[model samples]
Target chain A: MTVTAKIDVKNQDISESIRKLLEDILKTEIIQAILVSQHLPMKKMVMPTLVTDPDHLDGIDPLAPAFPVNAATIAARLTRKPIGEKIAAVLRPCEIRAFIELVKLNQAKRGNIILISVDCPGAFQNKDYLKFAGQNPKEATLRFYKKVMDGNAVEVEGVELATACKACEYPVSENADIQIGLYGMKTDESILVKAQTEAGDHILKQINLSATNEPAARQTAINSLITKRSSFRDEMFLKTTETTNSLEKISSFFASCVNCYNCRVACPVCYCKECVFVTDAFNHDSFQYISWAKKKGIIKMPTDTLFYHLTRLTHMSTACVGCGQCSNACPNDIPIMELFRTIAHVTQKAFDYQAGKSIEQKPPLSIFCKDEFQEVVGIND
Target chain B: MSEFEPTIVAFFCNWCTFTAADLAGTSRLSYPPNIKIIRVMCTGMVDPQYIIKAFLEGADGVLVSGCHPGDCHYINGNYKARRRIKLLKEILPQFGFDSKRLRLTWIGASDGIRLAEIMRTLVSQIKELGPSQSKLSMVI
Candidate 1:
């Protein structure tokens, strides 16, 4: 049976309530540590930190509107090998999805890890978040979530959420072992907590919290958010398709790229240990460069820009979780997410598959049926 | 303008299609010379990057011919190749590559005439499609 409970809020401090919850979880004998986003004392930036002591939960800020990096990579690292202790990870919805993808790829194991998620109100880009969190990041986090939960305007000081977040259809993660709710609840009084798995139920049973029924408004609010986001996503797809429908247009779309490869690095599902772009294969001889230039007469220097992007799409589009980290990592402010999400939509649809949707579904290229996809084979047929 | 002779890059599986090409040669079958054959151990080994590079480097068409289903020497290499092709067919066309430019076929070793016939038809089909847009324009 599913266990639904609430964390009582005092003094209107949601983060504190969450911190207390984490501290309680950490205090449990079953959980050795907790992985969550926290503010580093040295800097205002929030990053994923592993906390073993209950006292360290003071810095926990999973509600912080700062997504510096997808913690899935961190989760993968922690759970890649058995550490002999269980770690509870507090993650955003997209991070949980990406972690699920990593698990499917055999890059991570889920044996000793419990995934916890919150109803994501969305996040700002890195630059915008820095501006949003001027002096006190903790206060800024509270302000952002309060406004969102109150059904007020999301844009504060002319800055809004990231495009990926705005277009995100999944504000709630159904796959998480435990979920914290804020979309349609009286946060000033209490917050919702639900256990989705047996492990989550076991943990919830240890904590003394009053059971409650989910409010009807929660599903309605979630539906409205999804409707708004899906419309935005379709519009984005239309615009991206118009801009990159041809090779010449695609070249112009990525014209500002310097081949820094930050997008691939930022991608959680791009699991290659050694990308061919950085290998000796791409280290062409001087004569080869000259010959290539001589043939085209005016070839773009730092060549293979288009080649690199197309190759990446073919290699990783099926696994792309539309996390928007690629656009966040680009120095040139390229809308890399728009193009990737657009193409990924088509590629995933062609296989009737969705990336990060389920653990049972194998990756498109990883497994294939003998008689399937016959439409793709042969010329006359 | 003179009649267009499209340059086709054919990646044939060594166990099947490559042997068919060899059989065509021995049988004195007259196929179009526009095709440049590169024998791979299996069609599954023909990475998507190979097809993308050929298109970018000015090949008008690419063909990945392997054994028929269940005839794969390495079990299900051709099946894997099919999914990759289906994926590329969805992506490359979004960037203006005609779905016709990329193909996957199953030609058995003994079907020399069938292999020769498909090549003639492929070359003609590509001729109808004209030169690849990437060939006429600069790609970097």
Candidate 2:
């Protein structure tokens, strides 16, 4: 049986309790640093900060609605080579999933990291978050979490959750070594903390907390959220498919692309060390551009926008964790996440694969067998 | 009023399918002139980008034919190619490229007659399917 415990809440401040929990985790002798999102004091922007001293935990707020970047990329950086010390990372469900994909790609090592995920309430896009936070980020975070925990609509002010978050089905991470539960709990009383793996159990043993059982209501709450999100996701898939079903339509869908390539940079699973699109290979000869323009009668300058997106779909769709960072990073406001997730859903399902589900499951394209997918072979079909 | 001769780009594996094409040519087994074969070391090296580039540049059909499963000169290149083909079939169709426009086959070096026959059949099949969408409209 897994160990489940509760951290007492005073003044009904769940974030403060979680901060204290992390502070305690940081105090543990085995842990060298704890990586958690913090409101950087100067700008108050929520970014992942590594903390070695427990006193630096004041600005830590993993519950904030700000997701400027997927911390999986950061986690990959920390664990790419052994840091020689154990670190605990507090990540969202999607970040953990993306980190898992990075681990499978051999970009990240899990040997010295403890993954601690909470019941993700989802996050807003970067622009929407800045608007939502306005002058008081910490207060806005408190309001956001309270409204979400109250089981009301996510729209607090004029802003709603990012489309990607609304359509996400994974509100709870199953792969986390330790999970902090907030949904369906009496947050005024205490929050749920459970050790899901042997690593988590080892860490939990070091922390002094009273044991408790997970409330039956937690499962029900998670199920309802999943149902709501799945329906939204199905609707999104249909709409995205309609908009991008044809090549012409897909081109129009990305018509505003300036080839900034910010989306790929923001993507945690876009695993290339250096993308070919940015390399000199795409720098065509003057005559090549002239010929291309002459052939089409008029070619769009800064060519290969559609080609880039399609190539990315082929390369990264199977590894996509539906983090929606692509859409967040788009300067053109392209619904890149919808297009990617719709295609990713089909691609992953075609291979009977779910990206980031487990480290043990090899990436679909990495390994092949003698007798599978024969339906794709032969000219007769 | 003229007949539509679809342009097909074929990536034939150097050891097996490319040799088969050469055999067909020397043996006077006439395959349609529509197929422009690019010999590669293995179908495994025919990255998805190459196929996508062909389609985007208005090639009506793409074929990657290599050694049979256990007969790969590289001992598993054909298998890897099959997985990539399967991936493309899943991805390309989502954006309205008829999945039939792309094909994967296994034709051994000695199967010259078989290679020529399959090419004719593939050309006819694509001809019936009409020109690919990329050919009919602007891709970018």
**Relative to the true structure, how large is the alpha-carbon lDDT of every model?**
0.91, 0.91
- Top candidate (DockQ): 1
lDDT of 2 by residue, A193-239 (tens): 99989999888888999999999999999999998899999999999
Enumerate residue pairs that collide in model 2.
none
Model 1 chain A poorest 10 in a row by lDDT: A148-157
lDDT of 1 by residue, B1-140 (tens): 79988999999999999999999999999999999999999998989999999999889999999999999999989999999899899999999999999999999999999999999999999999999988767886
Candidate 2 error regions (>4 Å): A150-152
Cα lDDT tens digits for candidate 1, A276-308: 999999999999988987876778889899999
Candidate 2 residue-wise lDDT at B67: 96
